[model samples]
Target: MSQDTQPAYRRILLKLSGEALLGEHHYGVDPAVLSQVAEEVCELSRRGVEVGIVIGGGNIFRGAGLAEGGVDRVTGDHMGMLATVINALALQDAIERAGRFCRVMSAIRINQVCEDYIRRRAVRHLEKGRVVVFAAGTGNPFFTTDSAASLRAIEINADLMIKATKVDGVYDADPFTQTDARRFDRLTYDDALERRLGVMDTTALVMCRDNELPIRVMNMFAKGDLQRLVMGESVGTLVEGSRQ
Candidate 1:
């Protein structure tokens, strides 16, 4: 597909924060939000883009917070991983309910439920135009869904990684707190690092830069923002440069 004739990305990795599934609530998965997401994703698939998704488990579990209260780190991480599975299941169901085919693959062994994360199987699923949802945070402790998103993006050879976020783009400071922060339409990895931006973790950014994958950070909750961003419109901050 040519840029002038088709969708901007042939394949894409979508990183959805668990908080995004909350709709108006600050926590937990909301059915309505999940349905809306399904609608959006179905629309994207109909337009001929291969979509692979990675959803965070923050709403159901946040390991870092659990560890602060004296819970065993590994236990907390496992809980976090399970939380991601729950979200993945919800997303899978929602997507299917929207009448699109999809597969839920888990990094951890949960064969009775979702397919174990196998790189080739995942690629095959996407190639068939089925949305693939990756869950369980790389089946390891101390890694984040951000890192998992990057890993999947590379493994599947996605054209871009889309971070669906609360904000439209990367700002110099917290937009909710800093009135003076400037919103960027585009940026380089070095510039983001020098400014201490929190668009993604250092590891995720470095991996993307190293792989030379273009990343777009956008407020997906906004109406049609995902479509706009995926179509290569200026809907968010496009992080440019080689992978670090």
Candidate 2:
């Protein structure tokens, strides 16, 4: 379908899981997952959707777990940051392989591998019609990538933030384990906060809510779900202040 035919946002931030990049593997990165993500992202670009991306490092390193085991928080955070950088490089290769121009910008200066993250430079790249992949988890410790996604969304003035998760949508309980869990077609930030929904981190949720930013949570594993989410169609769950 032509992009003009069905796109809800002129610009969006795609928050992808590192595990999604690993496909079905027990561990490590998977080429198939990378290719699949590239296909979907390229489809969005084809439909005229400007895309910015934030990648998670869970599949690579869950440093918080290490910190719990007695490692210094800063060291653990550095490991997580490096993991995100690896995901960023993989995403850059996949996006470019799909024939869409993309730039990988890291919070840390890895001049030989990718460009360093500079707000002005990132904006310029986007304005120039290039997809920008943001990595390295805010370049600090004790902060999750979810927060980074929110900060980048606001920094780049994104229309919406599409969180590509493992579930079809958000539920009152874990859908996988709970048989009676129901999915909401839409929700408000207040409700999410009041109920302590696990859909997003409290800090990230508060940032988006305060800014009146809309967030869509959808299953990346489901076929066409991510694309549909980007187009503002019924996909997974839509959490917002109101419908436009």
Candidate 3:
């Protein structure tokens, strides 16, 4: 492959918010959006990138949101974890239909539906060129999938962690509401944390910083964005332990 086509990283962990699955809908997964994400992932796999994914469950249920409504926090969080399993299964089917092998591994076991999450097995799946979708949010309450993504990325020894969002990159202010917001092309971990950029949850960001794992935030819905990013093109805001 030519320089432009060569992948920048051999392995990556992709974090996708559940809200991203709600394309043009009030709630629930949208088939079109799911297929689009699957196709993007398949493209990466074909290019020799070992892909691992951690998807959130905010679309179907949010533990934090329910806690404000008098729901027990632990119960709400467990429900949220199950919601992630639903998303994982949906994505797995889409990826298979897109012509790539996919596995859904849940932190909270549902034996008949998916494999239980085992770190070694997950890594082995990636080594064998299968896309592994990690679900169920660390199998615990009070922890967001963002934390799960960081944990899984570190466990898998991923070269990079990419957080796919609706916005193009991290900004000083909400880009949608503020036209004057400045989008950062790159940032240091300290800069992100100090400024409270909200790139990821504090736990997630700190974990990546301590481990020196680089993070890239970009828009999931942007055509060619994921491809460009993995291919070494500058397509999003990259956060690292220090300025590179």
Candidate 4:
């Protein structure tokens, strides 16, 4: 596709796992991986696809993991949120270095470093062709970043939500362990929920369903996966509400 071509989804919310930034490392962000991700986003922006990104904190920290280690759940979650901010900053820097403008907006106030997320401001950024990165996971302790991605996508009027992960798509069982695992190319929101498929958290899935927002879960490590998805090529598991 031409770099000037219009994307299938005019605007999209990208959900990235913090662990994906780790690459082959045991933990934390890997510079090579982060740079590639930034390059992908930059390429999409160059193609006129308005993109908003939300990244998780699993690489640096996990609130649930800390809670299991005897830390306070709320405190652990707060730390996790801060971890996301760090990743957001790194990504913002990478995008900017790639000659694209990017804004880091945090749910929690970090005024000196980035702007506080305001719905109007974020929409305006997209209108002006600036990539917006959302951090801090809803600014609430209990919620996951997946829910934050859904909430922000709806607020920004995104055409679709994309969950970028290590796996290519959602399957009936864990593909790594289950040799016969079946991957679904398409699924009704209700069926995904009824089957207890972990496409995303139940809350995030419900939010998308209620809003009628479609989601594509695809593997980020796969070459050209994001580009293909934006160009309307089928490369991931699609989830949406069933129409009457």
Which residues of candidate 4, in runs, are more than 4 Å off? none
TM-score per candidate = 0.95, 0.95, 0.98, 0.97
What digit string (tens of lDDT, one per residue) describes model 2 on residues 185-224? 7889888888987878888888999897889998887878
Worst 10 residues of 2 by lDDT: 1-10
Query: In candidate 1, what are the lDDT values of residues 145-194, reduced to their tens digit?
Result: 99899999999999999999989999988899989989998899777777
Off by over 4 Å in 2: 2-6, 242-244
- Whole-model Cα lDDT per candidate? 0.90, 0.86, 0.96, 0.94
Q: Which 10 consecutive positions of candidate 4 have the poorest summed lDDT?
A: 1-10
Off by over 4 Å in 3: 1-4
Tens digits of per-residue lDDT, candidate 3, 59-172, equal: 999999999899999999999999999999999999999999999999997999999999999999999999999999899999999999999999999999999999999999
Q: In lDDT terms, which candidate is top?
A: 3
Native-structure RMSD, model 3: 1.3
TM-score for model 1?
A: 0.95
